[model samples]
Target: MLALLGACAPRPQGLMRPVVAAEATEQGRSVDLLVATNRQVVADPDVRYGNRRDPHLHLTAVSVAMPKGRPEGTVQWPRTTPPQPQTDFHVTRLQTLTTVAQGRGWMRQHRRGGHVLLFVHGYNTTYGEAVYRFAQITADSGVEAAPVLFTWPSSGSLLGYNYDRESTLFSRTALEQTLRLLANDPSINQITILAHSMGSFLAMEALRQMSIRSGPLNPKIQNVILASPDIDIQVFARQFTEIVGPRPRFTIFVAQDDRALLLSRLIAGRVDRVGDINPAEEPYVSGLARAGIVAIDLTRIDDTGGSHHSRFADSPEIVQIIGRRLAEGQQLTTSDIERGGFVMVAAGALHTVGAVVTAPVAVLEAGSRPVPDISGTLAADPDALRTER
Candidate 1:
C-alpha cells in the first residue's frame, strides 16, 4: 500500500491525444475546449509539446470528444490502434492566440455568454496531465460551462517540490491576468475556480494578489472550490484575510487521512495542511464558519485508489454531486448532504460518517432534511466504503 501510495506522484507526459484536423469520428461527441498555459513550447512534434519554463503565457483551443457511451464516472482515453469508437479524445483543432485580445475574443465566441470553469492542477503535474484532467473532469461532471485549463510550469518530477513551488509563485501574475480577462469580459456570465493540492496554494496566492492590487475580487467569479489543498493552515488564514469584499461561495473538500498531505505537513515543518483539517473539531469548524467558508469533511469516505489525495475526482458519488451542483449553480447545502448520503450533517457543518450531531451547529449550507436513498450512488465495492480515518 505504501509503495502504491508513493508511486501515485504526478509527472509530466505527452498529450493523451495528438493534435489533428477537426473531423467527426464514430467514437463520441466532441467537446471544444480553451486552454491557457505558461509552459514553454518544446519544439517537439510529439504530443508532449511543452517544457517547464516559459516567460509568457500562451492560449490555445482544443477539441476533446467524449466516448460514445459517455461512461458514468471516468473519461475513457483510447489506448489501442485505430482507436476504439466508444472511447478516445481526438484533438480536432489547435489554434494559438498571439495577443490577449485574441484570447479574449476566442473566449467570447466559445463561451456564448455561459459560465466558465477554470481548473488549476497540483504538484509534479505536466502540461499534458493538466489539460487531460480538466477534459475528464468537464466530461464527467456534465457541466455546460465552458472548460478552461490554467496550467503553470511544473518540473513534473517527484523531487522537484521546491522548483514547483517557485514556478507556482512565478505564474501568479499570469494566472491573475487570465482570471481578470475572463471576469471583465461581458461575454462570460460566471466563472468557477476549481483548484487541487498545491495548485490551491497558487490559486489563493493569485487571488490575494488580485485583491491587494484591485480591491475585492470581481463579482463574476461566483464560486471557488479547493480540493485537497496543500497549504499551511496559518498561511491560508493570512491569504483569506487579504481578500476584502463580499466573498464568493467558497467550498473546501477535506480528508483527514490524506496521506499526500501528511507528507506535505512533514516537509513544511510539521504545519497542518488545510486539506487535512479536522472539521469535527470546534476550533476548525468555527474558524471556517467565521471565514464564510463551507467545509466538507470526506475523511470517512473511502478512496478508490492511490494515496486518496484525489478522491474528489476519483469517487463517482462525489463527482456526480459536484457535477449536479455546478450545473445548477447551487451550493452544497445541508439538504444536499442528506440527499447524497456520502456524508452526514452534524449540527450545521458537514461531517464524516459516525460523527455525532449537535445543536447550535456551524452548518455549511442552509436548510435541513431527512436522509434520502443513496444506494444508487454508493460505490460498488462495499469494502471501498470503509475509510481509514
Candidate 2:
C-alpha cells in the first residue's frame, strides 16, 4: 500500500513553475482555470504553494495548455522545465487575485451561462497534480461551466495520510466560505461539486456545515458528484442525515475494483468505504435508493490507470458522459451511455442498466434492456426521489 501510494507522488519540487514561451499557443488547446485553495504560499515561483495550511482562502487564475490532439481523460505532465506544451501539460499564465471580492468579481464577469464546476481533489495530490488534472478534465469533458478547483493542504507523502485527512478538517471552514460565497452569488445559477476520494469527505462536511448554519443549501447549489469517495459509510450516512433541508442532487461513481479504496478501507478498521460498497446490497441499495442517490458502478469498466480510483476523469467514455449529461444537471440515460460505450474488460461491449430506484449494477449484457423489477429497486424516475430532509 505504501509503495502504491508513493508511486503516484510528484517530484519533490518545482513542477508548478510557469512556462513563459508560447510555442504551444498556436497548436495546443488552452483551458482557463480558477483555483481556490487553503495552501500556504511560498516564495518559490517554481513551486508557489506548499503543503502547509492557510487560515484564509487564496484564489488564483491560471491557464494550462495541452498538446494538440490529446486524448480524453489524459494529462501529459511536463517531464522537465520549459515544458514542451505540444507533448505535455504546461502552465502558460498564472495570476493571483489579491482578495475574495476580486475573485467573485472575476467569476461574475467570466462565468458562462451562470454555471461553475468546482472540483475537490483526493488524498496525496500535490498542487500541480490537482491543477493539471482539473485542466485536463475541463478541456476533455467539454463542460460548459467555468472551471473552479478547491485545493487543500495535502502532505503529499505516502505516510502522510493522517496529516492529509486532518488538513481537510482544518480547511473545512475555508471551503465552506467559498461554497457560501458561490451559493449566495446571484450571477452563478448553479454550482456543481465534483469531489474525488477523501476530498468527498471534505465536500460533505462543507455542505453539512452550510446546512446546519445557513438553514438549507441554496437551491442554486445543484449537484454533488463523488468519484470513488474514500469516506466511511457510516460517517457519510450521518453527514447526509444532519444536512436538514433541501440539498444538492448527489451522484456517486463507484467501483468495486478500486484498489485505493480497498487499501483505505483496510486502514479504516475494515469499515466499508462509500466508494467500494455494493450498491445492490442490503444496506447500501436500500439506503442509496432511499436517499435518491445515483451510483454508477464501474467495476467491470476497469482501465483507469493503476489505482482505478480516478475512473471518472481517466476514462474517456465516463468523462464524456459527465460533460454531455451530468454537467447539465441531467441524469444519464441508458442510451446516453450506449453511445459512449464503456470499455468493459468482459467482452468490451455496450450495456444498459437503468432502474426506477437507482441501484449499482456491475455490468449490463449487450443488447439488454432496463429491468427495474429484477434490479432490486422500485421507482418511477431517478430524479423524482428527494433526499431525506
Candidate 3:
C-alpha cells in the first residue's frame, strides 16, 4: 500500500509547468482578452447594414512585453474567441505600454531605432469599437509598426454622452505625456499618427504641447492623418496655428456630408464645424498652405448613411488610394483627385455657382461653403464623379 500511494503522489505544481511559458499566461493574465458589449450597427450590407440587433460593442485587451532588443515592426495579435461578424469589423485593444520618450531609459530603445504609432479614436465609440478601427487602419495602411492607442472612457451607454465628452477631456494630459516620450527619442525616425473625430482634438493638443516643449517640430514625423475629425473648424484652425509646424506631412480627410460630425457640431453648439470640412470653404492658419497640409473633400460619395465615417474604412476608393499611397509611398494630389472622378470647385466659381462633378452631389450644396475666389478650382457632383471610380 505504501508503494502504491507513492506512485500516485502528484508532482509539485511548478514542476509540472513547462520551463518556458508565454509572458501573459505566465503572469496569470491573458495575452489578449475580448469583452463585447452594447449593440451598435456593423454596416455589414448583407447583415442588415444598420441593424442594432447585432452586437456592435466589442472590446479587446492586449498585453505585450517590448521585445528584448530592437524589433523590426513585427507584432503578434492576441489569440481570442472567433470574432463575430459585427464584432470582427471593429477592433479595440487595451494595451500595456512603456513610454519610451519620457527619459533616458527609453533612449536605449531609441538607439535601437524604436518607433511608435499612436491612434486616438472618436466619439460614440466603445473600447471594442476603437480596437477594430485601429486594427483595420493599421492593416489596411500596411503600416507594420508599434501601435499605442489612447482610449478614453467612452461609456457604451448612449445616455452617457456628456460623460464621454468630459472623459475625453480628462485623458488629454495623459496622452500628451505619451507623445512627449516619443518626441525625446533620438533614435526614433518617425512617428505616425491617426486621429478620428474627437480624437483629432486630443491628438492635436498633445502634439501642440510636445512642440512647445521641444520647439518647432521634430523631423522624424512622417505623417499625421486626421480622418473625420469632430473638432470645430475655428478651434482646429487655432490649434493648428498653435501646435502643428511645417515639418511632417499633415493630411485631412473631410466629407461635408458627415452626419456624425454634424451631430458633433450640434452638441458643441458650433453651427458649421466638422473634422472633415472643405479647406477651400474656410481659411486655415497662416502657415497652413506652407505646412504641406492637404484637405481632401469626399463630398461626392453617396455614403449610404450620409456620414463620412465610412470613408476611412468603408470606401473602396479611399482604401485603394491609401493602399497605393502607402505601398508606393506616394502622396495623393489634385490629379489623383481628378482621376478619382471628383471635380474640384473652381475657386473662381465659389460665389456664383456651386461645384458640380460628374457624380450626383448629395451634400455639397450651395449652402455648404461659399466657393472661394481661388482659380483652377474643380467641382464635381457626388453622383457623377464617383460613378466610374
Candidate 4:
C-alpha cells in the first residue's frame, strides 16, 4: 500500500537518452564518471540498466555534460529526446571496460596525486539516476579526486523496497570485490567512500565482512561519509563494531526531520534510523561525544527540498565545505561559515580528547599513507575538471 504512493507520480522512465555527439559536448563541460554496477545491461539505450540484477560486475567510463550557470545541487535531467547539452545533462562519450586491468588503467589517468573518491548510491534509484546524481555531486562539490561510482540493482520502484533491500544484500559481495580491486591497484594511494541512504548500510556491511573474513579493512580506505543513511540503529551498532581496527575516519550527516527516514523507521519495526538522530538527545549525543565521531545535524538548516533526506547533497554550502575538506585531506571541523552542522561539544572538544590522547597505549596505529602533493592544480573554473577525475 505504501509503495502505491510512488505509483501516483509515475517516475520519468527512459530519461537516459544519450546524445553522443562531438558538438553536444562542446555545448557544455562534462564530468567524466567511472561507473561500476551489478545491474544487468539492457538492449534499450534509454533504459540501460533498468531493474534487473546481474551476477557479474560491469565497468564503464561515461562523460556527462555539465551545463554552466545552473543551480547547484540539482540534476538537470533531459525532459525531451536527445537532451540539449548546453542545459540538460547529456552523455557525450561512453565506453565499457572489459577487464579489471582496463578499469585500473582508467583510474590511473584520473589518479592525480593518487586520491580516489568512490560513491555508492541508495534505494529506489535507477542506474541513470545514480550516474547523474553522482555527477552532480562531483561537479558541484569540486572535490579534486578521481570519481568512481558503485551502483547496485535497485528496482527504482517506490513499492519495490523489499526487492531493493534484498538486492543490496545480494550485491554485498560484489561491492566487497570492487573495493578490494580498487585497494589492490598500485596507482591508487588514498580512497574515500561517499555512500547515500541504503548504500550506507551496504558500505558498512562490506567493511564488516572484510574485517571478519579478510582480517581488516584496507588502511587505504581512509575516510567514509554516510549521508542520510537509512540504517537501523541496532544494525548500525552491530555493523560498526564488527569492522576491524585501523578503521578510517567517519563523518555522518543527520537530520531530525528526515521524512524518508521517518517512513523507513515506521516500516522497520519502528526502529530509529541513523539519519534522523537528534544530535542533542540521549546516548547518541553522549555516545558521539565519547567516540569523537563527527555527526553534523541539519535539522535547523533549510533549503533541503521534498523529503529532507538529501541535505548533504542538496545544500551548496555543505557540499562545498565537505568537498574542500576531502580534497585537502583535512579533518572536518568548524569554520567561520559553519555551512554544515555545528560540532557539538560532545564531551568537551570531543569526549575529553585528553583522556583518549593520554591513554598509555602509545598511539601507534596511525596507518594513513603520507599525503602526496595530490594537487594537479585545483581548477580555477568550476566547470573545468582535470582529466575528468
Candidate 5:
C-alpha cells in the first residue's frame, strides 16, 4: 500500500526530485535528488579514495535524509535552483557524509550554546581538503558551534598558481558578502576564523573590506587566525592601518621552514613572503592602536624539515590552546602572548613565542632516512608519521 501510494504521488521536480530505492542503511541515512545543470561532483558515489587524486565533478542528483529521532541529523530537501554552467557545483551524498559529520556536530553544539568556527583553505586545496581539514578542526578545536568552510575553486595543482589567483579574485566578492550576512544575523553569538596559506589573503581581504565599508567589526567575532599567511608583510600593515585602524585581535602563525610556501616564493621570482619571518613588520594590529597581534614562531622546533604546515593540525599544544580559547573564551595575558604558549594569550600586548615540538617516543627506521612521526589526531597529523630514529 505504501509503495502504491508513493508511485501514485506526483513526481518531484528540479534538484529535489525524489526517487524510490531500498533503504541504503538501517543504521545510516539516504538521499536521492538531481544535480543542477552545470554543477558536478568530483568523485564517484561508490569510489571514495581516488576521488582526491583526480576528482570528477558529477552532475547528478544527491540528497541525505537522516534517520528520525536523532538530536541532529541531515535532511534532503528539494534543491531550488538549476545548475549553471559557470561555477555552481555540488557534492554527492556519499562524499558529503564523509565531511558532514563535523558540521552536524557544530549544529548540535550550537543548539546547546556555542559559537561558529569558519575555515578558509589556502592556494592548492580541493573541496575534499576543505572538508577533512574542518573535520580535524572541529575534533581538535573543542568548539561546539557550526563549522562552515568557504571553498573557492582552487585547482589544487602546484602549477596552477595563476588559475588559483584568478579564482581568488573572482570569488572574493561572494566570500565577503557571506561574511557580512553571517555577522549581521542576530542569532549568531560568536564567530572565529582560521585561514591557512593563500586563504589568509582571502580572509584578510574580507576583513579589510568589511572594516572599510562598515565602521567597526561585529563584536561577535573573537579570533582571526592566519596560519602561514602568504601575503606581503608590509602590504598587510598598510592595508590593516587603513581598514581596521588599530587593536585588531589577529594571530599570525609562522614557520621558517614551509616548503610549499617556499615553492610559492620561487614561482613569485623568489619572494620572501614564502615562509619568511619578520615579527616587527606588523607589530600593531589595525582598529586597535595597541599591539594586539599574536606571532607564533615555529623556527626552533625540529619541524620535520617541513614543520611550517603543522601549526593548526599537528601540534597537540597549539590545538589544546585554541580549543580552550574557543570553548571557554579564556583571556590571554601579555606575557603569555609574548610566549604564545596557551589558548588565551595576554590581551593588549603583542606576543612572539617559540612553539614547543614534542617528539614521538617511537621512531621507524627507513632505508636511508629517519621518518618523522606524523601521527597527531587532527587533519594534518605531523606526529602520526612512522619516522626512522
Candidate 6:
C-alpha cells in the first residue's frame, strides 16, 4: 500500500528545473547557490542538465527562487515553454565556472563569514536531484551561509549501486580539488560538510586524500554532519584517524531502522553500516564517545518524511535543529538535543543524555546500576516519547 501510494504521488514534471527570474512585484525568497559537479553535461536542448560522468567537472552559479505564498518545506516546479520564464519556483542566474580561479573568485564574492555549507548527496542521485535537494535544504534551514552542492556521478538508478560506488570513487580527485580550492582561499572562513549516505564515503575519502597529499586539513573546516552515512565501521575508523591536524566536530545521525542502510549492510558482506549502529550496544557507543563523535539516534522520531533513510532533511524538527546549530556556528546544544528527543553520547561519558518528552528527565551516570538504555527503551516505546505539536 505504501509503495502504491509512493508510486501514485505526483512527481515534478521536469527533472531539470532551470532558474527563472521573478518579476519586480513578486514576493518570495531567492537563494543564490554555487554548484560543483563532475557529472557529464547532457546537450539535450529540451532539458539542459548533466548526466553521470561526462568525465568533466563543472561549476555553476544558480539562483533558486521560491514563489510567494508557497508553503514551507516545499519546492514547486513551474511548467512553461522555455522553462525559464515567470514560474512558481524557479532557479535562474546559471553561469559556469570555467576555471578553478573563476570558482574561487565567485566564492570570495559570495562567502559569508568565510562560511560555506557544502552538501554531498547520497547514492542513486542525479545532478538535478542533488541540486534540488540542496536548494530545499538551504531554504528550509534558513541559514545565511553560502550553499554549495558537490555532485558526483551517481548512476541514479536503484540497481546501479556498484556503478554509483565506482563513480563516487572515480570523482574523489575532482572533489578533493574542489575542497582544496575552497580551503586554500583566504576569503573562505569555514566549511560545514553535510554528506548523506554513500556521499559520506566520498567526503571522508577526499578529506583523507587531502590530508595525505597536503598536510593537515585546513582550519576552515568547522563541522561535519554525517546524515545517515552509508559507510563501514572499520573504514570510517581509519579515515577518522588518518585525518591529521585539529579534527572538526563530527555529529552523526543514525537510526537502527533505516531500511536503506539495512540493505547496504546486507550488500556489504553483512558488516554493520555506520549509520545504523545501535548506540545501546556496547563497544559501538563507547567507541563513538571515546572518539569524540556525537551520535544522535533518530529511530524514535516520528516526523521523518517518506522513508526512515532521510530523516535528516525530511523531518522539519530535525532540519530546524540542524539549521539552528549550523547557523550559530556551534555544535548541538543541550536544548537542541533535548528538544529533538535526541540522546547524545559525549566523549568520556558512558551514558546518553536528554529526556524524551512526556518522560521524567533522568541522567544516566556512568558506573550507575546498569544504565537503562535510553535509545533502546525509546526505540521500543516510541509512542510514549511523541509530543503533540
Model 3 lDDT per residue over 231-288, tens place: 7665665566665345466677777667776666777786556454555542442234
TM-score head-to-head 2 vs 3, winner: 2
TM-score of each: 0.81, 0.86, 0.57, 0.83, 0.58, 0.80
| Segments in model 6 whose C-alpha atoms lie over 4 Å from true places | 1-13, 17-27, 45-49, 77-88, 338-389
Minimum summed lDDT over a 10-residue window in model 4 is located at 354-363
Worst 10 residues of 3 by lDDT: 377-386
Cα lDDT of all candidates, in order?
0.69, 0.76, 0.46, 0.73, 0.47, 0.68
Number of the top candidate by lDDT?
2
Please report, as a residue range, the 10-residue window in candidate 5 with the lowest summed lDDT: 357-366
Per-residue lDDT tens digits for candidate 5, residues 227-250, read 887766555655455444433466
Which stretch of 10 consecutive residues in model 2 shows the poorest summed lDDT?
371-380
Which 10-residue window in model 6 sums to the lowest lDDT?
373-382
The model with the greatest TM-score is 2
Report the Cα lDDT for residue 152, model 6: 88
Between candidates 1 and 3, the one scoring higher on TM-score is: 1
Per-residue lDDT of candidate 6, residues 221-314 (tens digit): 8788889999988788877776765778788888777888877888899998888876656677566666677777777666435457887887
Pairs that collide in candidate 2 are none
**Global fold similarity of model 2 (TM-score):** 0.86
- Clash totals in order: 3, 0, 33, 0, 40, 4
The Cα RMSD in angstroms, rounded to one decimal, for candidate 1 relative to the true structure is 12.2
For candidate 4, lDDT tens digit of each residue in 1-389?
35423433345445566675556434555788888888889998887776787877788898888776778888787766667666677777788888777888899888867888899998989998898888888888889889999999999877777898898887876787678778878898888899999999999888876666555677889888889988988777677766667678877777777877878888998998878876556667566655456676666667536677787888776777667785446666555224424233122323322211211101123233322222122221212212322
Higher-scoring candidate on TM-score, 3 or 6: 6
